[model samples]
Target chain A: MNSSANSTMPIANRTVFFVSDGTGITAETFGHSVLTQFDMKFKQVRLPFIDTLDKAHEAVRKINEAFEKEGARPIVFSTLVKTDLAKVIFASKGMHMDLIQTFVSPLEQELGVKSTHTIGRSHNVADTEEYKNRIEAINFSLAHDDGQSDKNLSTADVILVGVSRSGKTPTSLYLAMQYGIKAANYPLIPEDFERGKLPSCLPAYKHKLFGLSILPERLSEIRNERRPGSKYASLENCRYEVNEAEALMRKEGIRWLSSTAKSIEEISTTILQEIKADVRIY
Target chain B: MNSSANSTMPIANRTVFFVSDGTGITAETFGHSVLTQFDMKFKQVRLPFIDTLDKAHEAVRKINEAFEKEGARPIVFSTLVKTDLAKVIFASKGMHMDLIQTFVSPLEQELGVKSTHTIGRSHNVADTEEYKNRIEAINFSLAHDDGQSDKNLSTADVILVGVSRSGKTPTSLYLAMQYGIKAANYPLIPEDFERGKLPSCLPAYKHKLFGLSILPERLSEIRNERRPGSKYASLENCRYEVNEAEALMRKEGIRWLSSTAKSIEEISTTILQEIKADVRIY
Candidate 1:
């Protein structure tokens, strides 16, 4: 199930640690993907903000403890930047996966220069102009969420249209949070469907429109969780809304996909491809 | 500038590509982290959703084009699961950095099992219970946002309190999106200061409370951008709000941090550490 630390298992097949000078999010994210390849669950621990020599040594202690308890070398995925910190962690009693250091030497040789080896450089905040732009994008997306404002519709990178609970809000927030793209979402409610047209305000920004449709069964389950035993959560009404929404999207020539089975990442990536949104790599 | 593809560089010192059979986000994220170790900025391109042979070959062609144009071997970071597709891309005229495959074999040896090697297994979406929990957490955070409701206040994993523009909203959203933490945020306005205490509703949830403070100068600048020339945007008002908010937090023994110089990731990670939120590894 990929649930964290199954207690009943007592001893996990392997122990894993995501160590980083910053948040262990990146280390855990990539390491989790690598581990997903193997159909085995790891007893995972996240040791973040290990920016100091003492903290690095402390991390080594934790890693060694896990290795001894598990009776095998733990898997350590680290993004620690300081060479001294890296050396300390690499010497731990675990199969250390240094995400950053492995490539730094090769990259240094290729670029003919010394590596910065700067910890926490990857997530510098609003101090950088680019980071500030990301903040603005988040604000824009929030202000314009749920068709809240049309004054700045012209500025949006992509405007998502979908039936209620058809996975619009989370997707829009992800675009803003993850990619710094201004995303505004609108729910294709019964009113829009009865009009036999796309939302009147959306026509002017037709090219930027992306639609997310969902299977009736999944839509019903998701909605029923929010408002149970209501007509809005009924399969019949969900079917109607989905059909009409798809019809409107098809007629209006807006690119669309059924998001019933897609993750937010997959949906966002597809939208970026279709809208040709400028990829802003942080 | 870290901007993509500086044309004025004529031929960039190096060209880099993040190629993946999925969104390429994972590839780009780690690749970017590794690249940040070097001081030089390279021309960058992302080739995502390269699942088919045609798309895989297309990626190779693009990588070759960048190599030819840059007059240097490009660096390719890939997470493609299919061996045939990876073979095609790796054989291109660039230095290949397969993020997934590099560690896959080692992980296999450690786990003593053959990898499923499933493409897109990392983000299986709402089909999985964990992913559904993420969606529920996002919806929960959105509903409980800005202290909108106290009905579910006890259910919240963390309740963030701060003055306006202290970055509570985006931080909450990031926690929900990235880590599935049920975060609720509240803004400590002049009214709360006038009352000379924490919000009445927050006392019971003191154990779950986290506060964010900001530099008055930065707060004033951020608020001014939203509400130009208003008293709320004035530095004096911002100073009063921040001082009062921090005082309230200190009096309540609520753990807090200044968000003025932190990214949303940094802020969220700090909150997680303080709140002891159960780590959900997806």
Candidate 2:
């Protein structure tokens, strides 16, 4: 009665690294970055809390058994080695297992920091009220905002207006998730330009506004890729659009950030700081 | 009566950069990375696909006008300077503007790679069908997957089961987003252990089933943080759950991953790869 007998079991051959105090997001983020560097197969699991000391011992025992049964050393990534938990895992340290601990001992020595408490790095970011708010805001915005055309969004916590592909989606997502703010974004479409004005939905929340603009040449090149041989993808149209967009942004008095040379994280975080909004989640 | 009228133009106090050959994501990525290094205020815009000559001219004209209106030297991040657009922007280059072009002249000089034809970096990644499919799959999964608890998921493309807080939500989201798969996850509740059995719902999709295990000590410590002084968060209970869960995973032949040290990205990608599912978007 193998649990994987009926399902696709596509994850059978891959190794996964899951590190968490209990909630797995923090460890997962770091794990993902490391995983991206490799072209190998793997999977992830984040077990946030075991709920007991005996549970720690049980986990160690299972690790040893799984290793013996599989006949291969699975890669184990772990963090938050509390003394009681560490003792259990230490017993199974080298019995047919390859372990990669992300809360590296080397990192501790390099950073000149040590904690008597071993609650893993995942808990570090969560310990901040400010950080919590921002992440929550980011989630909130994602949940609340709709990326639909013709949706009325007059009541947004922050309204991001930018030309197409100006890092609005990620920025807004980040804001909503990190800050728990209800963020909405509107692309200043070509139609808006033809009419010589900002989209009507924008002015209703004009005061809580920001813009993202990129260099026109950059815009033209991006559009060219999508519609290779059309006037819409023409450099002239790009220039016209960029120019008009800037003029409109200025005319509408919407302050903007140039996506030209900024990362989504930076753009989102900076806007959050400037607006001085309440960014703490819980 | 412009909406921005009440606000002091933040443009003067901020720097803005725009980089493109068109469809601005690539330039924007680099732009974001570089700008992240600086502690400054900036805005962004992205215009993609600027192949025609006239558009380039107009972009520069508008940029020049923006400089005057803002009364500041704008920092322009750009790429693919066709002669016509270059001429227009060049007017602002020395006086009221500073431009950083991503399509480096030095790159051509150093690598001996010359292109009369304009191109972008994103095109390289987008050109491959496999890569495109993967991206598409990931996008599709993201749209469809909501990362909620599923009660009737016996027909899941994949099912992740683990103790509470075992990197389930993010991993599920990653699978859905990156592979366009319908993944569902169910928690191993305490009641299952009290009865010494796997959840009833799991056996049906047993083939596609998976387990996520973590060091019990890590798990215990994690749980302790949330509910201190309870036996549920005690070492003994943790040991019981760990041992029982492992036995359950082993007895049922549900492959389990130790999410002790890995990031979520690593875990998810690894799982995806192990399952031999290509990344895709719907």
Candidate 3:
């Protein structure tokens, strides 16, 4: 599947280019946000590692070809840092949106310092210490995932508690991957519901607990795919599990949210915002 | 750990805010890209879900407070869509960068259509079919991870083959989560090396195979942490395994890259680029 094109959606009517000097992931993210405001289908293309002048000319030719074939100017979103490369691409047949230079020049004026204007530094891949720590965080999240190990539970920055398929696993992984957060998760199982108590391992980590609940209908639909016609997939069972989970979280005074219609990014960002200390909520 | 601050880095002398009426992910991505060009430190903060005028006022207050405390204008990167909220935030003490409206208005003019300007549409969570497909891809990646299954080998969009801890699992998962690609990964263990051929199941899907190799030194370091003093962690074993795996991949005529120092994001992006069809290379 193309990253920007949905399979079930209509065929793309236009071409969009994410041109960057390095990985181009940041360019893609910026383009997606602005392009999402319009209700048009896009066939996205990425031109990465376009650092040299030769690569820049090649990129322009590609853009022109896309424009000529589509019978419309391809919309180009570029994060090219070098002045020469940007100069070449800006004059292509495509409509250019300079995502970097527009903001960077103004900020340079504000800070009274020139930007380095170097390529491949967008996310700082050269900082080995920071890189090592990021990998460590990912390893930690994997180790503590799905309540697999409680050995280092005390060191977790956050603990996610919820019923199965309530978005705990994916959310935990995203937290670690995107933000370098150390997250652990535990499922609220049938035994815990029957006992009407939190899991045994969670009492000592009450302050780190965050809960995720889901609508019973959505939970049932998700379970049905995994277990088919089993009792675990029944609506009644889903309702009981969701209600018990919510009640347990409430009794335990854990902060919670419903993940029924939310994206994993949404859930992770909200968790970070709510847990954000030092910022006063007016 | 804070999302933007490394643990051992210096104290932040600047305040940075990522504010959006919906999730602030787009704002954060854009901010990080631009801020990375400078030599400075930032105390990063996020203010999300500022849809209402009341919440907009609260966000402005927080920005102003940060500016006063830091004794400089806090750098605010905002993706708010509402005109009124944008006006309110633009007047705050912080130097605001309107990420949404900067290019959105130009695109609206170019397309000859008014933008929807709706809240919570940045990544399109409302499209439930797309959402379900994304979740399905993630589940598919997890199921096929680490040679865990061969049931759906033919269905994958890409198959990542690498030695253990050569960065296959995380790269596979990132490919799935970030781009909705169905990825399966397999490890090239001693048994496969001794056989002197590709894995039995992979022969049928040769067109879909991509390889990841690593430096023997780094591989040894990673394994030592997992099993201290074991033969598996010895430098000689790592050297032999890496050389044998690379030789096998070369003999099979498969394209491969080193994963020794590359980030998971970099590896996934390169995979997509190499696999991308229809775009001309000039």
Model 1 per-residue lDDT tens digits across residues B1-282 = 122222232443677888988778778777878877765556677788889999988988988897887788888878978899999998899987787888888877876778877886676544666677678888988888888888878888889999988999999988888777888998788888898877789999888888899999999999999899999999999998888998988988988899988888788877877766524333
- Clash pairs detected, candidate 3: none
DockQ of 2: 0.03
Identify the candidate with maximal DockQ: 1
Best by TM-score: 1
Candidate 1 true-interface contact recovery: 0.44
lDDT of 3 by residue, A1-282 (tens): 212234454544568898999888888788878877776668778888898899999999999998889888888998978888999999999888977888999888877778778776655362355556566777887788788898889988899999998989888877877776789999999999999998899999999999999999999998999999989999999999999999989988999999988888889888987777324211
Q: Which ten residues in a row have the lowest lDDT in candidate 3 chain B?
A: B1-10
Candidate 1 residue-wise lDDT at A180: 74
Candidates 1 and 2 compared by lDDT, better number: 1
How accurate locally, in lDDT, is each candidate?
0.80, 0.52, 0.81
Task: Report residue A205 deviation for candidate 2 (angstroms).
Answer: 1.2
Error of 2 at B104 (Å): 34
Segments in model 3 whose C-alpha atoms lie over 4 Å from true places: A1-12, A123-127, A277-282, B1-12, B124-126, B277-282
RMSD of each: 2.7, 15.9, 3.2
lDDT of 2 by residue, B164-252 (tens): 65666556654543333556777776788788777776687788877788888877886787589888788788877878888888988
> Candidate 3's residue-wise lDDT over B136-220, tens digit each?
8888988898888988888898999988989898888788777778899999999999999887989899889999999999999
